[model samples]
Target: MARIIHALSEIAQDYDALFCDLWGCVHDGVRALPEAVAALQDYRANGGSVVLVTNAPRQRASVQRQIEELGVPADAWDSIATSGDAARAALFTGAVGRKVWFVGQPHDEVFFEPMKLIEDPVAIERVALDEAEGIVCCGPFDPHAHPDEMRPQLEAAKARGLPLLCANPDVVVDRGESREWCAGALADLYEHMGGRSLYFGKPHAPIYDLARRRLTALEKDIPDARILCVGDGIATDVKGALGEDLDSIFIAGGLAAAETKTEKDPDPDALHAYLQREKIAPTYAMGKLR
Candidate 1:
């Protein structure tokens, strides 16, 4: 197994573009990770493309606003993409006027409310999957609740041939205080049952393609070899980069490690195990971007 490094300031100088993860690498929900933010700022100062891709359930614009509010340096990235933006586009391009059902936490309304949606899901009594045209899912019914809690909905949506649009493509998240499942898990289940799903965020080709297009617009031609993805989660961050055939730098102190009870620090063994399971390894692994 490859060893994880505690600091990686040297590697920053070699990359032309930095594809970063936002929630875990740059912030811990409430406050920004100063080191990670600074690393990005420093990288950008040296003329590197910094693109922050998040699996957040909100649009890219909303995420930018949030980043500004969190004190993340405004110029940290050259572009941004979110699962929400992709999900919305997927819906708009799909069959229109399709009655939709949303299953997510309370805050997820921001992602769907702008669409002039048919109904607010929280108000519905006994959500009837058979009666709906589609489902706009932002998260699991309970982040921590087991998959069985979602089985009924997934089975019903699949049986009805309802398209599931997952705004937050993340299957799990470090909720600042604890680990909880996100919308991605339910969407996966629905897909497993033969239901089609549209994912909007990181690790997905559309999102990466959007970021690559922005990078090209910034410069003449950006080589994939020069682009590097930095993220915390194995599924979204590492796997996302792998799918795109881009090098990734894993952050152990980010969202994927949020459930730890001890003081936050990078764990090498855990990272190696994660990499082994994936059958692919990141170019580097560090505690934080700083």
Candidate 2:
């Protein structure tokens, strides 16, 4: 039962800042969405702060570089709070133990890099799964493959009682037109197989706390009522906003494109039905960020 708006500006003035999702809202993984970029730029121009709250399983600096290469300029956002940073904080504190099994692409190696955030940090080591104390899953080794393919490894880990630290809780993402699996899929399978999986991203408290810190660093103490969450993931983004008791804008054009019948805009009836089925009630709904 959310109001459908044509542009973010329609409600921009109501919020002092935005907790924006990066992947599907600002860019499609391969490139920037020009209209979405313009909308964010306009919001910032009017003195509203923007914190890019992403579930990307990489540090903010690495994510900043990746977005810039994808055509997202520096002006569109003020700061970034990544799932990797939140998860990294937990890892360094030994949430999953010191010697853990690493599961992710080579690019995600930067996640293990040293950080000054922790005064007394655990010295982490990457060891073989059988020899390790816990598992750190940044993402699937192959995104295109089904989650079931990870059964053998997850099964062994379950019997061994190893805890899994899920960096990014997204099940899938569309890199351009091709959709691929993410770390969350493996975590989901692991939990189903009776293994314990820890989450730090959207719909969870850790990442939101990180995003608030990022926003506070900008000298803006935005109240919950004055902050808006923008994203495409119904489960992660909208659900997280609800959990945090913040107003949210659901970008239907991203993950729920088909379910909401979103072309230029989501079909009102279809969008309503989709939300009804999901049992999530965002503050507002729009086809895209623009």
> Which number leads on lDDT?
2
lDDT for each candidate structure: 0.73, 0.95
Model 1 global lDDT (CA atoms, 0 to 1)? 0.73
Q: Candidate 2's residue-wise lDDT over 1-290, tens digit each?
A: 99999999998999999999999999999999999999999999999999999999989999999999999999999999999999999999999999999999999899999878998999999999999899999999988888888899999999999999999999999999999999999999999889999999998999999999998899988899999999999999999999999999999999999999999999999999999999989999999999
Q: Count the backbone clashes (under 3 Å) in each candidate.
A: 2, 0
Q: After superposition, how far is residue 17 of candidate 2 from its true place, in Å?
A: 0.2
Cα error of candidate 1 at position 208, Å: 0.4
Candidate 2 TM-score to native: 0.99
Each candidate: RMSD: 4.8, 0.6
Q: Write the per-residue lDDT of candidate 1 for residues 1-290, one digit (tens) a residue.
A: 54466654677667788778888788877778788777787888887878787788877777888888888878777788677766766665553135677787786777754443333323322245667777888887678897667787688778877877777777777757777888888888788878898776777887887677667777738788888888888788888888999988877666645332113455556666666766767777776778
Worst 10 residues of 2 by lDDT: 141-150
lDDT of 1 at 285: 75
